[model samples]
Target: MNVRARPFIPAALAVLIGCTAFTSVQADEVQVAVAANFTAPIQAIASDFEKDTGHKLIAAYGATGQFYTQIKNGAPFEVFLAADDTTPERLEKEGDTVPGSRFTYAIGTLALWSAKEGYIDGTDKALLANQYTHLSIANPKAAPYGLAATQVLAKLDLTDKVKNKIVEGQNITQAYQFVSTGNAELGFVALSQIYKNGKVSDGSAWIVPEAMHDPIRQDAVILKKGENNPAAKALADYLKGPKATAIIKSYGYHL
Candidate 1:
């Protein structure tokens, strides 16, 4: 993944230039098509980015596959933050993005989560027991996390037995909601959604081992429509900055 960076700005000169730009230059809002698994951390990054660069970010969150289809049809999005590197690379190859502007923003983790406390345990005996009525997951064809979940199930040889009990969501966010709201007893979701402030937010969870599935390398790219948009490029650069990386890390994603 290659990221195009702007010229460095000295602290004093940057303040002077930024102060003038903040009041004089018209604000440009970068329209971002983001993957649902990155919703929380991206929101935090957007807040800081707006304050730091005096630029606004209008983000649309959903499955990467859906965003890819929309981008192909000219969705008017300036930036794409995909859950996997594959979509962005495909976009670039198809001439949907600015050349050489793709880069990995974060590596995500998948976890098994339940809304009910003590409903799940260290051992995944319940999975084989088939005690849960429904197991929620994002659509495998549309979501990277869902693909990972399927991989884990296959490795455990539980796919055939649990196929009838699966409920697929449009994206990871919706899948998480299914478990969090008890619509499904347990679900496979991104760790960033359930883990926050150094721990899981609710119920019990199993941090799925990386070996269980392929590494989820999330990437962001500036669309060809945003070739001349400063805000779009700025946001992409900010995503690689220390502050933004820290925020993403706090959400349980690996930088």
Candidate 2:
């Protein structure tokens, strides 16, 4: 998650950028498979990248697990922006991606959020007493964020106590919806979904401590389909630039 001047210009494109005057890359679209947790910031970054490089991006956002299945079965995505590094690394090992194209783009943060203000009292300590009617979380088996949420509960010794109160979502986006819509009083969700402009937008939340779970090392990789596609490589490169890093940080992610 280091922010550096990485603009994934193809060797041919590099000369074009170095010139004082240059045309952008061809108007080709990159098909990206993105994790649900990154939905907001990636869209913003994609827009900026399109303007700068003239390469459009079409994104499919969902659980990383589902994307893995689709990719293994020949989903035509040129890039995979996973919520965890594990998936991209696996893709590389399985020959689904361009070699040496994988790198962590962002480190994600978790949050315990509620729809109403003043509802969540503190750092999930109140949950030990079973105070809430229902608790929501992404399906741990499918979503890395959900797995991280389970890890936090385990660290706090609340897993067994709240087993029955749990409501699961197919992905992090849906899990956030459960809390945002009052379907569940509270839920564990990616901070990016609830944070903007240096604050939580509409809910009470506790930024889950990093020690509770392993780092959510989100990585991006160019898939085999994009091995020769300049647009796909360029998008992957744009993800490491200052503009993309700034947008990601604004959403409460770290680089």
**Index of the highest-lDDT prediction:** 1
Total clashes in model 2, counting residue pairs 3 or more apart in sequence or in different chains? 0
Tens digit of per-residue lDDT, candidate 2, span 138-234 = 9988899999999999988889989999999999999999888888989999999989999988868888989999899999999999988899989
Root-mean-square deviation of Cα positions for candidate 2 versus the true structure, in angstroms: 10.1
Candidate 2 off by > 4 Å? 1-25
Q: Please report, as a residue range, the 10-residue window in candidate 2 with the lowest summed lDDT.
A: 17-26
TM-score, candidate number 1: 0.90
C-alpha TM-score for every candidate: 0.90, 0.89
Q: What does candidate 1's lDDT look like per residue over 1-255, in tens digits?
A: 999999988999999998887776656889999999999998999999999998899999999999998988879999999999999999899888899999999999999989878777845666667888899999999999999999999999999989998999999999998888889999999999989898988898888899989999999999998899899999999999999999999999998
- Stretches of model 1 off by over 4 angstroms after superposition: 1-26
